[model samples]
Target: MIVITRYSVPEADSVAFQTDAATAVDVLSRRPGFRGHRIGRAADDPTLWTVVTEWDGAGYYRRALSDFDVKVQAVPLLSRAIDEPTAFEILAGGDL
Candidate 1:
């Protein structure tokens, strides 16, 4: 599986950002080959949230990103410093 991590950074409007983020998560999770996903936020760091998405493979994510709605919903949540997100290959796993 391919693991993609999107980092949410601070914004002028935290409420709006988070609200949009929640919706995006719901939408993306329904895409094909999206096996599973998780949302992470730090208690002491409001600007730091991680969206860990598990895909069937990198190709699945690439194909999903082609959807206009998905791109529209996702772009705003990304930090300016983050032109792109990071992806990893899952070597092992257990119960969540």
Candidate 2:
């Protein structure tokens, strides 16, 4: 499973946002069902950032949300994500 969360950040807050995102990733990486993650800023829109995380499954992702560290260190940053569908199930893939 993959979760794609997009955030709209103002240029003035980019530094702080990146810092918090790094911390969020660090905290989440320590969680048991976390596969990996990637942080990205849109080439066309610098203010648009994304946090993509691969998880073992939806359950693992949900459980991670309930974790203490996640709630403290990550939830604040995650709460800024644009309201929309974020989680996805892999149905097909290919090497890039």
Candidate 3:
């Protein structure tokens, strides 16, 4: 599975940022190969918000990145909202 983690510092003035992110989450939830997503408010931390997502494979991930319009729409919203950027990982997980 592939994992992507997002730590966001949202724009001070735009409610649209959170709204858009939530919408994207809803859309992604309906897609094939989407495992799940988790979000949290960083603990007493002003500079962070956390998002984690799991996908079945690189192909599904790539399609989500390249083919989904909702995902594309998120770029500008994130740009306006985020301070740093999203982080990603291709994980190797199995029984040891």
Q: Each candidate's TM vs. the true structure?
A: 0.75, 0.96, 0.62
lDDT of 3: 0.59
TM-score, ranked from best to worst: 2, 1, 3
Question: Candidate 3: worst 10 consecutive residues by lDDT?
Answer: 78-87
Model 1 vs. true fold: TM: 0.75
Per-residue CA lDDT of model 1 for 1-94, tens digit only, reads 7554545566565676567667777777778998877776768778766666778888888777777777887645543324464778788989
lDDT (Cα atoms) of all candidates against the true structure: 0.69, 0.95, 0.59
Q: Estimate, for each residue in 30-78, the C-alpha lDDT of model 3 and write its tens digit.
A: 6677888875566787456655667777677667656466466644543
Where does candidate 2 clash, by residue pair?
none
Q: Pick the candidate with the highest TM-score.
A: 2
Candidate 3 Cα outliers beyond 4 Å, as residue runs: 8-16, 77-96
lDDT, candidate 2, 8-96, per-residue tens: 99999999999999999999999988999999999999999999999999999999999998999999999999999999999998984
